[model samples]
Target: MQRYFIDSNVPESQKISIGIPHYHHIINVMRHVSGDQLIFVFNAGETYIVTIEEVEKETISCHLTERLEKTVELPIDVTLACGLPKGDKLDLIVQKTTELGIFSIQPFEAERSIVKWDEKKETKKRQRLQKIAQEAAEQSHRVHVPEILPLLTSKKLLLELAQYTHVFIADEEEAKINEQKVFKKLLNTMKINDKLLIITGPEGGLSRNEVTSYIEKGAISGSLGPRILRTETAPLYAMAAISYEFEL
Candidate 1:
């Protein structure tokens, strides 16, 4: 069954009226009929099996059939912050990380970032990523859709560090020196529901000054492993390791 993330909560009446974009996909793309069953996920992280009761020109009415169990979200909230990379790598990161159960994603300007966020198209780019995350969440059957935060500068990112319970950075220098336990140690210390923020650099990697600045913000630096992963690969590795540790 096709899945959709709804904008409102499932009311007691158990009737949901879905309109355009969703209605278009149901009627035109998926070619769904009035009796076809689908999944509707609400903003509150609730999933329901809904049956299409009526299909009109501009809207589709769905009656909730059954509520599904909710256990797909990560035990702890993990946000991945990436120093903006080139091309469509950020799109891959957002899509994959959402499937692996990230709480949110933040892209910031690092000292070595090659691509700069276009001031005029910033909102457009962010909306594109948000759509990617929503689709990924629905495809992966995730209860919660991960958010794609607006672009920020390193200084602005530092100011938001206080919101996370723990912070870590993936540094190539740390990987070269075999500094591995900091990330695992931090994980071991954290209980369920803790919010963690991890940062990865761009293709050129984070500058020494940027690393020092992150350290000053109380973020522990660690290596993903002995190998130096690419800018886009590092965040995915971190998220997978987190799932292995907490979900396995």
Candidate 2:
């Protein structure tokens, strides 16, 4: 069944109108007809079954039929911060990480980050990442769409570390990789609404000063494993591992 993300304000027994783009897919591309059943999520853990009523030029209206089981969502909030990698790597990271159940993603400009996104480029970059995340959420059957935060500099991001309950910075030089030990600490220490921010650097990784600044901000340094992972891969790895540990 086709799944969609809708605003929570849409009430039961009322008309469910979808946007033109999705309407086109349902009407023209997928060739769905009246009375076709669909699944919708207002947010995480909220699902509803609806049947198509009318398909028009700009909108598709459906009748809310029944309430489905709440979609499975991650238990903990995990935000993966990547040190903006070069080329299309960031797209893959955002799409896959979203499917794996990350709460959100933030791309930061690290010391080794090569690509620069000024005001003009930042807008376009954000749109592209957001599109990728949305499509991924749909493909993975996620109930809620994860947010892709605006790009930030490492220093600027570090300044806000206090907001998160626990901040884990992925550094290869950190002590041995013990997913259990790190997660155990998180289990023993973390509570609901506690944001877990995981930072991963670019190809060349972060500079010593950058890591030091993160440390000063109280972000604990953690190692993923013995082998080094790419900048784009590291964040996904950290997010998936954390979701497995904390959510499952």
Candidate 3:
């Protein structure tokens, strides 16, 4: 069955109406009819099996058939903060990480980052990334879509670090040191419901001073392994490791 994320509350009468994009997707794209069944995820993270009852001019009416009880979210919330990379690398990161169970994404401006997003570009880019996240979430059967945060400067990102229970920065220098397993060690320490922020640098990677500043604020610098990962690859590696540790 096709899945959709809905922003409205479940009706008391168990009747639901879907409009616009979803309606178009059901009617034109998916070619769904009145009797077809679909999955609808509501704002509260509740998943329901709904059956289409009536196809209207601009909307499709669905009747709630069953409320699903399965949980598809990561036990602990894992947010990825990436130093903005050039081209469509960020797009790839958003789509893949959402499939691997990222709770949210934050793109920040790093000292070595070459790409810059002005105010206009930031808004447009965020919208596009958010759509990628949503589509990926639905495809992966995730209960909630990962949020795409507005671009932040390195300094602003530092201040936001306090909100998370744990923070880790992916450092290339750490990869060079033999027997460095700080990332795995940190993963072992994670408990259910904790909030973890994983930071990955861009093409040129984070400067030593930037890593030091984050370390001083209590973020642990860790290697994803012995290999140096590209700007886009590091976060996916981190998220996959997280899923292996907690979900698998």
Candidate 4:
């Protein structure tokens, strides 16, 4: 069934209303009309089987037939703290990671990052990414939409590290990351609701000085693989591995 996320308070009545853009999608692209069925999710575990009942100028009304509980969300909260990458690659990162059940994403300024969002534009950038996260969450059937937070400097990120229990940075240079030790240890030890912070560097990669700083913060090194991965791909790989490590 075609899926869309709606506000949590969507009533349990036979009829439900959708906003203008969604109406356009139903009327135009989807060609949905009366009697067509769709899926509506709160994206935090409440799903309704909806049947199109009425199509109006700016809204499409649907009828709720049944509801189901969602079981797809990750057991733990995973935060991706990525060093701002250049160009449009971050768009892919935000969209795909939201689908993978990441709890939140943070963009931090690394020493070698080529693209910099200054004090003024950082907030706007984050808001845009958050919108993308919401859309991805709806499309991917995620239980809860992931967050895209305001920018942080690497130093600022390190300072806030104590809030999370499992903190690891992906270092292509690290030998320990390749071994099963860090992941195995995480699987054996961490609790379900434990917060996992994953930090990935930028296109220029983390400088030696920056690597030293992260290492000092008790961030154990984890390697992705043998090939040279792009800034965006590395985080996705790391997140998938983390999901496999704990939830599998």
Best by lDDT: 3
Per-model TM values vs. the true structure: 0.71, 0.68, 0.72, 0.68
CA RMSD for every model?
A: 14.8, 14.4, 14.4, 14.6
Q: Residue 184 of candidate 3: its Cα lDDT? A: 83
Q: Any residue pairs clashing in model 2, and if so which?
A: none
Q: Which candidate, 2 or 3, would have the higher TM-score against the true structure?
A: 3
When summed lDDT is taken over every stretch of 10 residues in candidate 1, the lowest stretch is 185-194
Q: Write the per-residue lDDT of candidate 1 for residues 131-151, one digit (tens) a residue.
A: 999999999999899988989
Model 2 RMSD in angstroms: 14.4
Give the TM-score (vs. native) of candidate 1: 0.71
The lDDT values for all models are 0.86, 0.77, 0.87, 0.77
Writing each residue's lDDT as its tens digit, candidate 4 over 1-248 gives 23577866667565778986577776898687888777677646576667888888888878887665444776568899999899988889999888778999989999888899987788778878988999999998887988887788988988877888878877776634345366545544655457888888998778778778877877766667667788989888876876676445
TM-score of 3: 0.72
lDDT of 2 by residue, 1-248 (tens): 24566766657456778875577666887677888776666755476667889877788888878675534566457888889889989899989888888888888899889988899999998999999999999998988888999888888998778888788888876647564256446544654346888888888887889889988988878677667787777777776776666444
Better of 1 and 2 by TM-score: 1
Global Cα lDDT for candidate 3:
0.87
